[model samples]
Target: MSAKRPVRRATPLRKPVAGTPAWVMPVAVVAGIAVLIAAFWVIHWYTTPLPPKPLSQDTTTVVVSMMTGLPASEFDAVGQGTANNLIKPVSGTKLLGSTGKPEVFYLGAEYCPFCAAERWPLIIALSRFGTFTGLQTTTSSSTDVYPNTMTFTFRKAQYTSQYIDFRAVETTDRDQNPLQTPSTSEQKLVSQYNIAGSIPFVDFANQYVFTGATYSPDTITGMSWQAVAGTLQQPDSTQAKAIIGSANLITAAVCKITGDQPATVCASATIQNLEKTLK
Candidate 1:
């Protein structure tokens, strides 16, 4: 009679502990380092500040200096034909402002790359005849061609001149959102003269129409606000050749509409030469 010996439960097998492969530890370390690097990159991308959304105080000062101080002699040297391809002559009823002065109407959107480029010469040219207050710095649309092109915006700006009246319509913002709507008269002008239905259109007293930028925006691409403004001082620089050259032509156009008033400006040998070539 034998009492069956208590069956002993088989000992549970323990997890086999083989020596760790030399490659496994290095692989684990490398994988861990890669994860840390990825995390750091994501953090840096989200935290890094983008280019200043608006002009800083220092940048504004530079802009003011450049716009107000570009030498007339330098602009003359840049010469004509830079804007000839951009501006066209149109003879119709005269366009006058509220003050009975000839009006220079500019219709454009901040998002427009051409508008961005045109504004440089436009501001420099207008500054010759008058002063601008409340000018703000901005960039063109990030999604548009020539994205992020730097320039000034006239949204909160005002211009005063004894020679002529300047009117700017920043129809849309840098994001292509409507910033300033065009007036009924402005709309009519757009429909009438802007046959191309494009932005950055300029109607100089209804005597001349500028359909697009006078020069390639590429000239100033990747330039900082300060750099672009500073280039106006250097006549030999390509930026000056494009920006100041266009300005000279615009000055000539405005002089024609103003009856060549402010003789100091229109009488300049360079402007006079450009005036003769104006179509």
Candidate 2:
């Protein structure tokens, strides 16, 4: 009976698939790893907090320094005419508002490099007489000239001052998309004074109008917000010279409109000297 068992046939080994190679398995594994890595990066990019976009701690410190007045010696070195080339005097216009306070109207787009450059001194000058709430850190248009220039946006900001009323209209966002549209009065002012239709237009109680930036945008092109702000405390730095100089001129103009209400600011010898140079 033991010898009666039939010999079992050896099962034939299966052949490899006709066209598939052994390397296919490793290639598939590598592709899967790459996909996973890309997904992680995409998630991180969306989740991370970026610098100078939403008012970081460092940005806040810099803003505070700007709001605080600089040393008298610093203003002296920069001189009064630093912004003379960009500022123009306008006369024979009605008061901006019925609030019985002098009004400073700023019309600009977030995408404008000129606006970006001008905002620095404007913030500094205005801060001397008032406090700003809800200021946001932003940059100029990435596609426009002097792209990504660090600056602040007044889009959500409110300025409170005993001497003046600050009105800001950010016409477009950083992407050149529509943001805040100008009102009828604002449009009329622009049409009548901003003959070139350029941005960064500022009307200082109809006494002075700044058609463009006080300094060239190139001054702060390659610098970070911190770097530019740090230089503000340095009187000799080119950044300080331009920024502070422009601030002094703007301060002088504002004082003229305010009749030097706050003696602490308008009475400063530096500001008094700067006032003499105003047209």
Candidate 3:
């Protein structure tokens, strides 16, 4: 009687769906391939962006030699061709530096095309007063305007000089990821001077400030490192005119901070003339 009272209830089985739709698998496969391809691109971007690749000795040699070796004639010839008015004064600013010397503070990112253009002259100008080591070569962000412009990155770089102190920061890599951090004081200068949040922000000891490219990135947009370096020696080349010209102008700004010292550079007829234009 107990057993009969405990009669088990039958469990109902759910009906199974019919054969899978033919389009489902193919669509899924295509979607999976798309995802893989996208992931590949994200992970395997073309240029080596981070931990910047050190410039080749040959490249460095050429860069140093060409940048440093340029006859003052080339600079005199270029004579601030297109850099006119690119650098402007930031008034009522305190001079920033260390060790009884004026500091040249530079802020830029590797992805910045304007910064890319500006670095050429900055380096050339700095090289005249000092020496740079650990310089790395890279291109601007491939997706940015005037994309893939061959240039140098200041990350992992060092500048030494008796005339002045050089401070540079590559705030981000080509991927737009943080790479270097500027000092709190440097950030203060940036905040004060860089209202536009632009790249290639250069402060010549807070006396003169340049906020953008002195010349167009297009000047060397399609050129390779070697091509850019080679063309720089050509006084008639547009690249030289823009880059070297800008260097001459920048050199003049630095001279003001240095009290027109190193008569070799500050005394040069071209630099002296450009210095007059700084104000």
Tell me, by lDDT, which candidate is best. 1
Where in model 2 is the C-alpha error above 4 Å?
1-53, 57-62, 66-69, 81-84
lDDT of 2 by residue, 69-176 (tens): 576666666665345456678885644554679899999999899999989988988888898877877888766788788888999988899899999999999878
Candidate 1 residue lDDT tens string, 160-207: 999889999998888778888889988998889987789789999999
Q: Rate the local accuracy (lDDT) of all candidates.
A: 0.85, 0.81, 0.84
What lDDT, from 0 to 1, does candidate 2 have? 0.81
TM-score of 3: 0.79
Better of 2 and 3 by lDDT: 3
lDDT of 1: 0.85
Off by over 4 Å in 3: 1-55
The numbered model that scores best in TM-score is 1
Per-model TM-score, in order, reads 0.80, 0.76, 0.79
Error of 1 at 212 (Å): 0.7
Q: Please give the distance, in angstroms, between residue 252's alpha carbon in candidate 2 and its true position after superposition.
A: 0.9
lDDT of 2 at 79: 67
